[model samples]
Target: MAEKIPAGGTDHPGRGDWPVIPDEREADLIGLDLLDHADGPDLVLFLAGNQFMAVPELLEAFRAAHPKVRRIFCETLPPRLELRQILSGGAWFRGRLVTVVPDCWATVSEAGVAALAEAGRTERGQCRAYLRNRVVCLVRAGNPKGVAEVADLARADVVVSQPSPVHEDIAEHILAMYRAAGGEALAARIMEEKREAGTTLLTTVHHRETPERLLAGTADAGPVWATEAAHAAALGLPLEAVEFGEGLDQRGRVRYFLCPVRGGAHPENGRAFMDFVRSPEGRAIYAKYGFLPV
Candidate 1:
């Protein structure tokens, strides 16, 4: 007898009883066509975000569950940019099945959630939350620099590298926290020094690339999600994390969400994948990656 396929299997076109949206616009927008076309051993799932490493165990489990799904197309862009691509419909080529992980603290605000809901209204499908992640700062191993606290970051000898505050929402939050902690004078002094000495003390890069630079010692410190930092440490990289003395704000800890592009071809599959992510097994994967379940 042939191997028994799972009940919700995607191996056969119609075996899983997957909801098939007839309208091509909805199907195409959600990436149903790509799923149909790439029905063999190489199904492509495009994921864009900053915390890729935080969920290795979860990914391994996902692979174990769905062996046919191969080739995860990923981009390490900042969440803000990812949001822009979704809003502008820039990912039409990658099939309508675009899955975006927005910065948990930055993009899941009341206004942000409202905006996403509006966007979904225009599209045929919808958006939903997948997981939550904690943002933390990564420092050199052993913190030999004595940069033990966020306030120490304002010291002259310290070089802080972060993503652009304007486009990188998490960076903006850190900046806000710094200002709240009375780092404004320090920021002004840094600006003055830059104007007088033409020295750039602060550096910001796209979110995905921040970790690589931190591991390479290109920067003394950078902001990163807790799980990403954990993964880096697991890799034996010379990195350590400094959680805020007061801890993350109550609301900040529960902000990450996964949004499915509207009018895409793979709403049903998208929903299924999301369901798997929310399942007990999926939660375990997320926890292993340092993300809290939603």
Candidate 2:
């Protein structure tokens, strides 16, 4: 079983705070936490990893379109972890005394959505693609290692911060892209040889740690979703996105899909939130944060 998120831990942000009212500061709220129904949020979301930057904007737009949904709570976890939590009906978040189920769930991998459907976790015919993205390399500002593309990741001189394939789907995408560029030899070298030599570092929370590693000068570069790199740049962080050429960076579009959870307490509001996410306004909000509209 996957490790449970320790409830009420201050080590990571968004532990105890949840069911927040949408406000101008929404975009700045990027922490994962548990929610309590005692306050009664109108809608709750269990979102896939790496959407920390776009969700707040999406929530704000959702509120504007549906004023009735005044409170929204969300938990952003790795898709597999989120799926496991959904299957189990609730998760034991750090510091949280009880488990809480969400009304809606979104994942970057369609496979995750399919898993939920196969498990009868979502309402039938309710899932849809909402946003698109691609992969890229995130390097420290000025790109100290002079890394430019996926191929350079294979270089002996370029130390890399890599995500764990076991934990994040994006990690598999990265390995595949590397294979496409230089075959399995490249993938093996990075995943095995370089990893053993400490030239390739693995991250526990891929998306969050990429920028942290870069800023801390612990890694020369790391593969990440384009939006993640963009979010870091938008925040004026000392990081730069290095785009890969065609057939190299997993340029074949990745996607974000959402569905209302079946048997959830707030089915009506759940469907409404899904509709708002697919609306033009929702797409615009995603686009503003570097997501390509589906």
Candidate 3:
């Protein structure tokens, strides 16, 4: 039997500390995807997954400015999956069907925005780029593997945590950076040869998981958005970045595009949120989390 240790290791009770909020629902699924007002949201947003860290700040400010919008449901999944969800009419979650259509959607890929326009779900001209980001090699603090640049990821000793091109939109961009650094051969070596060799770890969500991989010693390094590395550092995680710089980092190419869904439930709410996103306040919030401004 395991002995139970007192709270705080000394049974030191503090004011308003010991409590458990009772659950009234039969099944309360837990996840951060559903933010602010969970049920009956007036405005819904489907955002690119890597931008998950910025959602809270964006929401708080949005609420402060537009107090009437009490419920705002935002889902932060990979942009591709989010697009598919929007196109498919609905998606299943926890054995339940969630058919809530997003009023607004954002993606790092123009193709994703183009797809929606092609489907006639959103008007083509409304989609616009709002933010920019670039790739970097995320490494543990001190960079024990001594990875200096994007090309260094191909070194025999560096185990790279690469995002899967199939799931994450950022993966192909990172591969492009590899191509810039050491040409197509280097890109093939990292994604093909080393991937088959089990040294290139493919992550479903690079921004969220690469830090975990680096800290847990599962990966020596990873190619992730520079903002992701900065966001991880801000969280007090033992992580840092080996910057790919302007040429290799895909500076102009890595633009974040946004649009309001044409036939969404709340077009007014979506337009208001889009204003906030491109506003000075929105840019500041994203910059606070290390995103590059458009």
Candidate 4:
């Protein structure tokens, strides 16, 4: 059977005991393109998948600061895929269904932000750093895999789950970390050899599926953002974080960037949201969820 993508932070309320969106059912409708029964969202945010845990608190602050803005739509997915959807104005859902375009966008790397600007998707000047994070290995509680470091992922006995480099910017960092820890041969072993042997499973949505793979015993460990692992533990999920050695894991180096989409449907709202994400109050909310704010 093929692996299923978990419902994601969209359905469940997160670690802060706050819902990313006010209503799961309503968010589901929008995600599924099933309902046009209500007014369109005031602000639509396209964000990196790893930041899902902070959405509820971020949205709460956005609402408190801008009370007039009521229906906000936030979509979190891999940055590369999200950028493609943004450039094309929409994304194909189940069987060619198109979802609505978002007003603003945020990515785990500045590369996506730069690409958007270069491609004329978003204004270059408006893009800025929003938050920070680092790579970490998420494992089953108590570290049953004995994955003490990045190199351990290369062991024959370990089965690892990794995100697709085609869609996730984090994949690049993970690969670089692997190369730093061992060498290109080791990187190839895990990225190619082990993958061909079914020992390193590739995930479509890293943030949402990695934890599930760990819980299901299908994946012994996976590289993910430190904040994501923290969020999982905070929610009482059976997962533990394994910090990697400096210079190898790229710890204290990852920076997330955000921008207002050019020619967006709600340019004003996009600007407001861009500002809100950088606001002191907004940074505090993200910090509460383990995200390192700018």
Candidate 5:
């Protein structure tokens, strides 16, 4: 079983503080102890799900800048629901004050930001966008099926793997774009023809997993992040990414944010972290990973 760390303990040097440093041997017990130090009103950033791939370096950078930050807990949830929780002040994680920062695709209009300010809520503007990714058809080493576009997904023998629309918002957005681009009818036709239509294609693979699966011959085609695909190509994944002419809109890219909860314990610390995130140094790190500075 996985080791469980309890919440709320006295502050001391520990392993959890270094999220970027991978543990090669045993689980870092010191790090877990540090998490217990975070208590009441302390800043707890709840990242909108789907941005996990780029978190390691960002966390490392933040920790380097702000050592006083007692604990940094990264949690993930659906974007829409996370937004509602922030707006409604719902209880999350043992009633500790929480701030919601949606992934990149979630865009808050200027009006929404202004409204948040008028309501006397602190706007940290910590969330930053880094990379843009698109769904692609990943095939084995060679073009066996001759798959080219979204329309080709209708081929009787073609096996396509996709993530569930309910959990994978990106997949849903991709499907929406595909339909808007006139591929809807074709998609329906494919489903009707293939009685063994597989929703299992919608497995919980991450952006990196798609490429890995394709290279391993586990999947013929799967959705993958463009940056991950680029990195995978560099690593020689025997895969090719077939881009659909009409792709998901710019809104599909994931964004990261740093927000201060209304009643947070460490408002000052949260603000400091947010400011650092936007500073030249922070922007440099984000840019390194293909993130755009806000």
Candidate 6:
């Protein structure tokens, strides 16, 4: 196993080894964590992993619009970990302590913005919903596992790569979807009983693990953002997305927010990026990834 990254590592010794991203297959196990120019950027950001597909295009366009801000470092970690990294001051990634301060923080809920504001570390900026997404079941082609709907996820034969509620906000929404489909019993069966039976594989980074596990045939299906499944499918992965109706999928619950970090090194860059995200062109980038723009 690769060295585990410690959580809530706010106070580290100092800056040292920058993240050494593993190869593609190896990284599928750890979720691609780093994005953009990480080595000394004029602006840094902590973004939710689900919307990761839109970052490269968004950043590239933002840079083109404003060439002054050349370097931009963005970390697409889970929202909770991203919050902890900002609150704790740094992260002990692998064995190295990374201490880069963030200029912006984005998450699935406003609670992330509130948390930073409470810490007095949040900057005054456009803190509002910029994107939205809903749940879907990612399954193999031809529907071999027979997972046709959300309720099928609770079947005894199915093994699900469920995201950890403790680490990811999406888990609660997924749990709600399960409850809507099969009541509390279904939620318990998949989240508790199946997990005990070694059927529910908890994933810290479902964006990477869900498709990886499904394609590897280790898991029959997983609940993921529609955007995630679409992004993976676009990459030529042999997978199909099972759409959940509004009654089952938590349609209006998932909203994404971007909060500027107070006292960041580059204030203008953060503001510029946020402005661009709300622009029509920015919305197009997110829309390209199957995300609903706010």
Candidate 4: TM-score?
0.85
lDDT, candidates in the order shown:
0.51, 0.72, 0.76, 0.75, 0.49, 0.76
The stretch of ten residues in a row with the least summed lDDT in candidate 1 is 19-28
lDDT of 6 at 61: 93
Worst 10 residues of 3 by lDDT: 20-29
For residues 238-265, write the lDDT of model 3, one tens digit per residue. 8888876788888879999898887688
Could you tell me the TM-score of candidate 5? 0.60
Candidate 2, residues 129-238, lDDT tens digits: the string is 87777888999888888997676887888888898765566886788788888898989988899999988998764457778888888888899988898888789998
Q: Show the colliding residue pairs in model 6.
A: 10-88
* Local accuracy of candidate 1 as per-residue lDDT tens digits, 14-52: 322222212222311222333334342132233434455
lDDT of 4 by residue, 149-207 (tens): 77789998999989888778899889889888889998999999999999999885444
Model 5 Cα lDDT, one tens digit per residue, 252-271: 54333344556554567666
Alpha carbon lDDT of residue 96, candidate 4?
A: 31
Error of 2 at 34 (Å): 8.1
- True lDDT of residue 191, candidate 4: 96
Quickly count the clashes in candidate 4: 0
Clashing pairs in 3: none
lDDT of 4 at 12: 22
Q: Could you give me the TM-score of model 3 versus the true structure?
A: 0.84
Candidate 4 deviates by what RMSD?
8.3
After superposition, which runs of candidate 1 have C-alpha atoms over 4 Å from their true positions? Answer: 1-48, 54-60, 63-76, 91-112, 120-127, 183-205, 248-254
Report lDDT (Cα) of residue 186, candidate 2.
86
TM-score of each: 0.66, 0.83, 0.84, 0.85, 0.60, 0.85
Q: Choose 1 or 2, whichever is better by TM-score.
A: 2
Give lDDT tens digits, candidate 6, residues 1-294.
122445666333443423332233232222223332244568787778776677778888988999998766677777776677677666555454556677888888666677788888874355767888899999888778888887787788999999977557788789889988889998999999999998999985445688889989999999899888888778988898888898888888878888888767887888888888889989988888888987
